[model samples]
Target chain A: MNKEIGPIEDLIKKLNRLPGIGSKTAQRLAYHIIEMEDVEVADLANSIIRAKKDTKQCSICMNYADSDPCEICSNNSRDDSIICVVESPKDVEAMERSLSFRGKYHVLHGVISPLKGKTAEDVTINQLLKRIENGNVKEVIVATNPTVDGDTTARYIQNILEKYDDLIISRIGYGLPVGGDLEYYDEITISTAIQNRRKLD
Target chain B: MNKEIGPIEDLIKKLNRLPGIGSKTAQRLAYHIIEMEDVEVADLANSIIRAKKDTKQCSICMNYADSDPCEICSNNSRDDSIICVVESPKDVEAMERSLSFRGKYHVLHGVISPLKGKTAEDVTINQLLKRIENGNVKEVIVATNPTVDGDTTARYIQNILEKYDDLIISRIGYGLPVGGDLEYYDEITISTAIQNRRKLD
Candidate 1:
């Protein structure tokens, strides 16, 4: 029995489960948590719970929101005819941060990856197709990530939407480095990448 | 108004408040939280709240505990006569890892630092003196950090305990680097440093 760890070991284990947080980082964070004021620590905990509890996927665009339609979906100023579909809410945020994309967003929650056992059905592609079929959407920009899975998912969606010839189907530019996660890229690169997007033949 | 930030910014702000987590790290963590399973995210949040709510200071020694006396203090096999005084619960965990000392512990919560506006009264020095006054403690081992502030606090405690002729007062040795933190030091170094402690007088 590693009696040395005691209660703190349990705390480190919990923290280590967080994404990108290794054991060493977890230990540092756990020590910091123990040193924090009870109220401060409690508030941090509450925020996590609140974010999970309050946020839901938008019914129309699939972006995260407190309401089903989401603030962006419900808003009147957004370009209703242009829907930018992406892999996750983080991607939606990345696009929005550029201050250039005024269209609405559709968050797929994930991409099609057979290697990871993720199929097209596993993502929100069906919901996206339903939205496209409903009408008034002039353009459907596939803003999925630059990964193999993202590209595959984008192609699959484009093929499905090709049946609706009246709608313009386009993919976001691919200047973003292959295999680079979108969340780490800056606003300028993402904006330039978006503006220079190529039309898929 | 930066509508792109919206609710995501709130999550990032909360994450940044955590110790050692900067804005970039906080953003990464917030995005990760969004990506995680709702159950896993909830568990992490609940752990934070539970750790803060369920844990408290041991009334006798001031070490963090789920119960008043703490497990070490309440344990029958442990030597209650030797109280290993440390700056925080993290220190207590360090000593416990060594398994070199089979005695109880008293967490001071902080050390004396006038530059940071922390004084002797700010720490648990009075409680320590009171514990010593109970007459059961034969040795009070000051295992506080080895920093300048730690040294000052240890000296201050030694000065206060000088009035009591019946009890033996000792500070952990200073072979630890002058400016280094105790939390990062290894078990062997800490154990050797403690075993080699010399008399202050």
Candidate 2:
């Protein structure tokens, strides 16, 4: 009995396609949007278009950027000799949030997920290797996620880069997250934490 | 240490302004949008703008519509004499979903909330009275939510319309939702359900 409103329905369907938005949430959002001021709605629409059109993949790091090299890649303060390789641009952002890494980054775009038919050739693995082959790079940290695909991708990169005797290829440590409770942690995490236990400073 | 990507950050900020989206959810959505195909992102953005530009409020019912009168208002089959008055355009959609109500709707836009400084004069009460003044309407059902403001608004409307001798003003029934367990239901709901109970057929 619900009479269809064409444009609003279209908007709701479009919103429902987003990662976490459900059909109900989409409906709520659509109604909320209709209630919003015209100028505010216009601003939201313009921002979406601007975000899509203005951002480009950084040629050097393969991260989303407004500029070719991106702010991190072009910065002289960051160590060019050390590179932290990650799966995606969002991963680079997460790494940066830790505020400890002063090194440059290489974004692989994706991991080698065989189940999904994503091979090493599918992502920017060659581009990452090309960045490290410049001879100036000494430390190459493989900071991909701890999933099966992440480990496979890291291993593949490590196997190829093994000839570089001076370069240090290290995976980011995997253990219980900081401030995490021991009782709540899974068995693998607890064991890994024990295996990678550090000396008291 | 997370260096701002101009357009992406702006988009995230814009998304965060939405009713239910948190900062983290906004960031995730922004990233997802960036990952989407150019055509898909354009479609999504265009839909937002189109929804805003296309819809107009029905002059008769004050519901959102592509046409001035709205589909429901213009439908000759719908019972105009029995007007179902509710808060907001979304409430009209909710009512339509039930499929039992063939009557037309009148959207009040908001309830009289004294806490929020909204009075009976602030909403579309005058417009509602004007509609009833035409002598065509015989029954007016107040379907505002079961809140303090809802009760106040319903009472206010009922008091004002009492002068119309033939008009029957009624409020929507409040009871336990379908498939809801009685043990989980609040005391007020159980009491209301008992008070409004109908005899077994």
List, residue by residue over B1-201, the lDDT tens digit for candidate 2: 675649998999999999899987898899899888989988998888888889888899988888888888999999999999999877888888889799989999899998999998889999899999974999999999988899999999999999999999999998989999999989999999889899998
In candidate 1, what are the lDDT values of residues A1-201, reduced to their tens digit?
555544566778988987778987887787777768888887777777767666677888877776788888988899989988888777777787888698888888889998999998899988887887785898888888888898999899888888776788888876688888776788988887778776665
User: What is each candidate's fraction of native interface contacts (fnat)?
Assistant: 0.45, 0.76
Q: How close is candidate 1 to the true structure, as a TM-score?
A: 0.78
Off by over 4 Å in 1: A1-16, A21-49, A162-168, B1-12, B22-50, B162-201
What does TM-score give for chain A of every model? Answer: 0.92, 0.84
lDDT of 1 by residue, B63-91 (tens): 77777888888999999898888998768
Evaluate model 2: give its TM-score. 0.89
- Model 2 bad stretches (over 4 Å): A1-5, A175-201, B1-5
Tell me the fnat of candidate 2: 0.76
- The DockQ-based CAPRI class assigned to model 2 is medium
DockQ of every candidate structure: 0.35, 0.71
Query: lDDT of each model, Cα atoms only?
Result: 0.81, 0.84
Candidate 2: give the clashing pairs.
Answer: none
